[model samples]
Target: MIKEKTFTLKDNYVCTSQHKLYALFSFLSARDAYTFLCNWFEKFPEHKESTFYIAGESYAGKYVPELAEVVYDNNNKKNGSSLHINLKGILLGNPETSDAEDWRGWVDYAWSHAVISDETHRIITRTCNFSSDNTWSNDECNEAVAEVLKQYHEIDIYSIYTSVCIGDSARSSYFDSALFKTNSRISSKRMPPRLMGGYDPCLDDYARVFYNRADVQKSLHASDGVNLKNWSICNMEIFNNWTGSKPSVLPIYEKLIAGGLRIWVYSGDTDGRVPVLATRYSLSALELPIKTAWRPWYHEKQVSGWLQEYEGLTFATFRGAGHAVPCFKPSSSLAFFSAFLSGVPPPPSR
Candidate 1:
């Protein structure tokens, strides 16, 4: 899979270039994605008949559905000669779905997990109107949020139970520069360092070192004709300046759900960023009828997490997992993913 140029490109790339003006928006990004997919299908027409499912995690919760809607709309246009995408459904992990719900959940999660004191939680809950666009402008709310950040500063907020990277390696600078930036906008809040698999505290550091090497770049053709120097897991410049994102993608979810797409929303129960509580709140707002009652899903004769099926969607949780579900609970995540692809529920009992 190719990285999005808006976040990955460096130096003379359109997103980073001083001469070009670029605004990152979900709908625009979706249109560009549709183009990419069309080109891909053209090149690999042999796979055109295969079932196509869009999948992503974190912020992609917004992107995947928007892109799917675009594909869906295009396929249904009469006299439209666009290649038909055999689209089926989508999957998301620890997605940022709604602004108000996410903020409420973040504060509630911190308080419930004993990360913040009773007073701080009380002040925030009393003073902050999460539904307001300018909730952070209130002094009490701002102070309470600052306290939350201060407490979370010590631990890996992405995975609260994990150890922080304290290595003195040369790449520590990357870790320091990358992880600590904060934005006033709730949507631009700092994200965790990229994680692939397992719970290694210093995995991001290792990844940065490996990807920045001359030989590695050469082998991957990452530096060809580009003035790429440093390779970061995230680009804060793009993140902080992102524009045109709706405060919530819940409306998009409703539209896609009505279109009969096999939507599944999952969470890593321990992620403090886009926590499970946030997902629960966001999905609850849909008010979809329950098709399958909530219960524990099993993997390898052990409890993986809970699952519930809505009329047109499914929701699941990964026990003890962090922001990156597969990275934290690989085996359980695999079983969950297999069930999704098979158009069946995850095993209800061991």
Candidate 2:
């Protein structure tokens, strides 16, 4: 029997031209999904007491906190009408919590990892002001960023060191086309290659094949109206419609941490997109007193990651892992999950 339960939400953050006018920051996809979860819990009273923990990675760094705030606010409300969700804690992996810090951190990560030249890094740091939503610090900053980006054109920004799947030679046509489209966003022709270490660069190809299959869709009861053949990893329309992002989640972290909730922010050290450096810089802004000194944590008698406990939040970094920690380091991620849920610290030192 399964001891754990999972509830996944395919939040349609898409807003067409007509629906765009009504779109508000608070009523976006995450909020909508939270409302559904709350209502679901209310309808199914038996599971009301079960410990609920919100978890996500990457962009979810933002989504999880926003949703947690919604849950926390409702739970604390005096009104007896609302159900008190047993929200135990929150878990975030390589989250994009702050725009300014993340961008700033990216330059640092790139430079430190030898992805770009020291001179370029110096120019970027000197000119770029990541504090605002605008892309570049200045004209010079934009040029410096462009110069650095050229170096990463052929590599997977998500996993800087890992190789990505090339065109139809290694994967199917659909996968090749998807990769092409991604590169087209940056106006680059070169594609990424797949590297070793239990990584499957062709997983997107497999997913495209599996989801587009008639029988699989039928079994899952996917809608007939939506064309499976055209399905992509990320819907561009939905991504374009995402208009509610804040500059930083530090304020939200301040509120939630002060309220005494278990918060864990873990990063896969290898991920260049939302690198561990960025997470560190963002968390430093919180200025939470250190509850435990920084140290390495172990799993299966091996060093899994480094973890440090703040007053109410914990920050961790999985060694040699990518943006999606579970995909790259499943065992370590499971260890982290188990510890987060149990309110126990990861084993110190291997």
Candidate 3:
């Protein structure tokens, strides 16, 4: 069914420190992405050991670093301005930490999954700028990789339906300034009441994936022509390219990592789109000395995940997961978030 889905207006600039690995920082914007995030940190003190995290699925993985950077940079600037903002660590799940390495991971994942064949994997892997000479000729290796991926996908979907996990949660799509009392809150005119986007928070669908054009027109308080025009600016940006042609966010993350922030990057082991291996390579460019060697930490009886702690950054892997780690491992995901929130180390893996 060729359904014309209408999207919210997109901004020309994301207003972040850098493009998230693959757009993780989509939520950080001049509009409210930055404002809300900064505010979240500022208000965290009210909650004991409040650490602000830039969390989400798919694109959010990419958004984490930039959002963290924006908060950090802005906090410094605010303190300079005689205002104080207490910013802490970042928490990201299934994050897109590296574009360069991410592509490599994607190829590796496709190669590993039965969804794609050996021929297809070879074509994708070879096409990337950094194709590894590493070859897997054994049938056993191929079968194992495929099984690993299937297990990952299975765990991911199970979590989503079972928990209040939003799958494609690009915060920009769901944000309503009105939700916040500050001027930063979503303006009714700029958006059809944000309430329209999945009023039920329990369900993960925050933004209306199916943004109906007719509903949008009807919601605009202004005349249809003017409302349509305004809506288009925000809507077009959702799925289409905005004022600029190309997409990028590496500079933003580079800014944060270079600035000495506690950047926590974790991924679902099974997710090919943003694989754990790819994240490691992305950090390799930073050339930071590994503060701690790679090791496993546990949530309970099972081995939770592995960690690579650099002086300023840390990378973690969710053992049996896909893109949505929290949904896949709710208790563990919550524990991880709590750690990010409290600057506490998770239980050691057995």
Candidate 4:
């Protein structure tokens, strides 16, 4: 889906930003997909009352809440013909809801992990306004950011503690076409066959191969105008073509939370891409009162990770998991999801 070209009254010309481009996709695809499901339920009355939950991870952090807010708004409208979607809650994992806070926390996280020195961190904290939409003209801030990049040059920035696939080149550049390339091949490099939790870091490579197979695509009815071999796991063209992003999702959260929608945000502790620190910093801006004190939640006899309940939100972390918690700690993630759907916290012992 594409954002239709529109005129800007201020400049008296057609204009758009990356955010506007992606927003069009969300409205055409994501929101319409929700409507289709709701209509399906309407046709099949037996499941009409079933609750729907919006869930996504990473960049979806922005999408999930926006979609939920849309659903919530639709439910409230008195439009006689509209479907009242029962959007019960939303689940976000390592979400990038606030670009400013997330990027600011990235530098702080790098410093805390010793990827950069304290002095550099101090300089960056004072000099940079990562929240700004414009490019920085300040040389000192640019130099500081460059140094931080250099420090993390060799590391697996996604999961800082994990082993990087050997053949994968260290990603030194900003988000670009390379982002799409890595999703299909990163796991295929010379990483260990398996981690302790039976997580295969190279699974993306296997998926890439499987999805591109003509037979497999045929079976799944996954034909597209793009050739199967050339269809990337992630559409780089869409990502690269994005014109801009909304400044913050905090206001959306505020609106949804006030509207009484259940909200839970979880993070895998080791994720460097949208680290736990970033999540914490972003959420802190909301300043919600604590409904429950922070404590370690458990799965079976062992501690899974920490959790905290606020007036309108629940925050949790998977102890040793990375960006994708289920990929690393499936059992614990299942437990978390079960509790979330049930409108309860994970039991202290189970």
Best-performing candidate as measured by TM-score: 1
- For all candidates, what are the clash counts? 0, 4, 22, 6
Error of 3 at 227 (Å): 14
Per-residue lDDT for 1-350 in model 4, tens only? 11112221110111122112112334444455555555576568677577989899987887787667666755775642245667889999998877667878777888888888998898878877765434255556666766765555456666678775544311212332344222232211011111111135444456666787887776776764245654344554455455334446787788788888899999988877678998999899889999999999999879999999999999999988887789889898998999999999997654
- Tell me the deviation in Å of residue 240 in model 1: 1.5
Q: Write the per-residue lDDT of candidate 3 for residues 119-235, one digit (tens) a residue.
A: 656644443243222323434333433343333332232222232234434333333222322123111111111111111222334233323354554565444533443332234
Off by over 4 Å in 1: 1-26, 168-198, 221-228
Candidate 3, residue 94: CA error in Å? Answer: 1.4
What candidate 2 gets wrong by more than 4 Å, as runs, is 1-25, 133-137, 168-198, 217-229, 237-241
How accurate locally, in lDDT, is each candidate?
0.74, 0.70, 0.49, 0.67
Give the better candidate number (2 or 4) by lDDT: 2
Q: Which scores higher on TM-score, 1 or 3?
A: 1
* TM-score to true structure, per model: 0.83, 0.80, 0.57, 0.78
What would you estimate as the lDDT of candidate 4? Answer: 0.67
Residue 245 in model 1: shift from native, Å?
2.4
> Once superposed on the true structure, which residue ranges of model 3 sit more than 4 Å away at CA?
1-31, 36-53, 78-82, 130-237, 240-254
RMSD of each: 7.3, 8.4, 13.8, 8.4
The candidate maximizing lDDT is 1
Steric clash pairs (candidate 4): 17-243, 18-242, 18-243, 18-244, 19-244, 187-202
